[model samples]
Target: MHVPDGFIDAPVSVAAGVVAAGAVAVSLRGARRELGGERAGPIGGERTAPLAGLVAAFVFAVQMLNFPVAAGTSGHLLGGALAAILVGPYTGVLCVSVVLLMQGVLFADGGLTALGVNIVLMGIVTVLVAWGVFRGLTALLPRTRRSVVVASFVAALLSVPASAAAFVLLYALGGVTEVPLGSVLAAMVGVHVLIGIGEALITALTVSAVLAVRPDLVYGARGLAAPLKLRVGGELVDAPAAEPAPAPARSPRRVWIGGLVASLVLAGFVSFYASANPDGLERVASDKGFDKSVEEHHTADSPLADYGVADITNARLSGGLAGVIGVGATVVVGTGVFYAVRRRRTGSGDGAGSTGGGDRDTAGSSA
Candidate 1:
């Protein structure tokens, strides 16, 4: 949920800003390693940066399609679970953060003053909880593509309520007005629980689709979907495989173009059919009588406020143009950030004069 200014007191907002900043810093470092992409070698492939960028853009685009969750409440993709399953947890945090940044600065959807709150509640908390649950569930379940999808569903389902609880705790600490903490907690959790179901379904479906097409690109499926080997004389034997050409099939261009087209379709056209009801947090805040505390966004006068371009009177065209612009900007920024991280990782490895993981790992590197 996009928390506006004045919903959270200044002290608590600043505290969250500090926490968010620290978390982002940590995530950036972790992303370097997670995205330490192998240079194109005998088993030719593309770097991880572009895929990570697409994750950010895709999250931004899907979030625009708010589905009805209750009578007056709708829910959009939080995307932590989806991104973490597709990319990695470290990169996933950055993806959501990038969307928040774009929305706050350009679209006036989230307030600049409350950016930290949104980042902490929606980005960091969701990613941490979802990723933790995913890893734990995957460890317990059978190692297969189906298991990965199941784990994604469970993790995403739990993450929504966990984020709601975090918001309640923060509000309790720095609520500007007198509100019943218990009531707020109950309403927030109740509405968000419904939203969590939607999150789980979307996360599972997206993860399953990606796994089917390009399992190697899914970070969570790494080491889980290895090709089965033969058992000979009570010993496991590696199956012989054909050598790939110099230019491997793991070309980023195909996936990138496909993802870009899908994002365009979803944001430009499909979003027009999404429910127009208030999202879960907004509904809960209104019902709980705390919505009056929200301050007008500072960027309310921006051309792209509320996901529609200003001065474009046509509802469909205005919204569609804004959505396309948002996707383009997000991809550019996300790719730049990830590309830098990947370069730093590669540079570090070169300086250290170390070959990455040994032969076994490198040989299996498919996208």
Candidate 2:
């Protein structure tokens, strides 16, 4: 849920800003490893950085398609689990953070003053929790594609409510209104539970789809399904490891193009059918009487405010154009950020001598 300005006091917001900044800084360093630097070996090393950018744009586009949850309430994809499953957790945090920033600055969907709160809840908390749950479940369950898909669902399902709980904790700390803490917690958790189901389905389906085509690109699915074993004379022995084959040059390119197309279709047209009702957080805030504390977004007059073009007369066209622009902008900005991170990592590794190969191997194995 996008927290508007004035919901939390200035001091708490600034504190959250510091926390968000620190998390982002940590994530950037971690992302250098996840993006695989300039190494050229692992199943998807060269592709991870570009794919991470596409993942961010895709998340931005999908967040526009809010589906109906309970009556008069809607919820959209949070993208943390999906991104973490596809890319890595550190990059997933960056992906959601990019989306939140775009939403706040361009669409005015979330408030500028509350940007830190949104990043903490939707970016850091969701990514960390979902990644933890996904890793735990994947470790416990069978190492199969189905297991990965199942884990993705459960991870996504739990992440939403965890984010809600985090928000509740924040509100308790710096809430501007007088609502009872217990009521707010209960309502936030209850509604987000329903929202989480929708999130799980979206995450599972997307992960499944990607795994079907390019399982190597799925960060969570790596090293899953242990190497086969064979029986020789008497006892069973592990099968000989396959020789490492160079990755095809065009595979990731095709996947990237396909993903971009899907994002365009979803945001440019499909979003028009999204439910018009208030989303889970908005509904919960209204029901609990705390919504009255929300202040108007300072960027309310922007050309793309509220996901619509400022001068377009047709509702459908205006929103669709804005969605397309958002996707384009996010992809451009995200790609630049990720590529820069990757390059920095590459430059550092290059300066460090021959040890770069071992480090690349380690990063690939972990990724």
lDDT of each: 0.85, 0.87
lDDT of 2 by residue, 214-332 (tens): 88778898878777889999989989999967656445888899999999999999999999999999999999999999999999999999999998999999999999999999998
Candidate 1 C-alpha lDDT tens digits along 73-153: 899988988988788898899989998999999999877989999999999999999999999999999888999999999
Top-lDDT structure, candidate number: 2
Enumerate clash totals for all models, in the order shown. Answer: 0, 0
For model 1, the run of ten residues with the poorest summed lDDT: 37-46
Which residue pairs collide in model 1, if any? none
In TM-score terms, which candidate is top?
2
TM-score of each: 0.89, 0.93
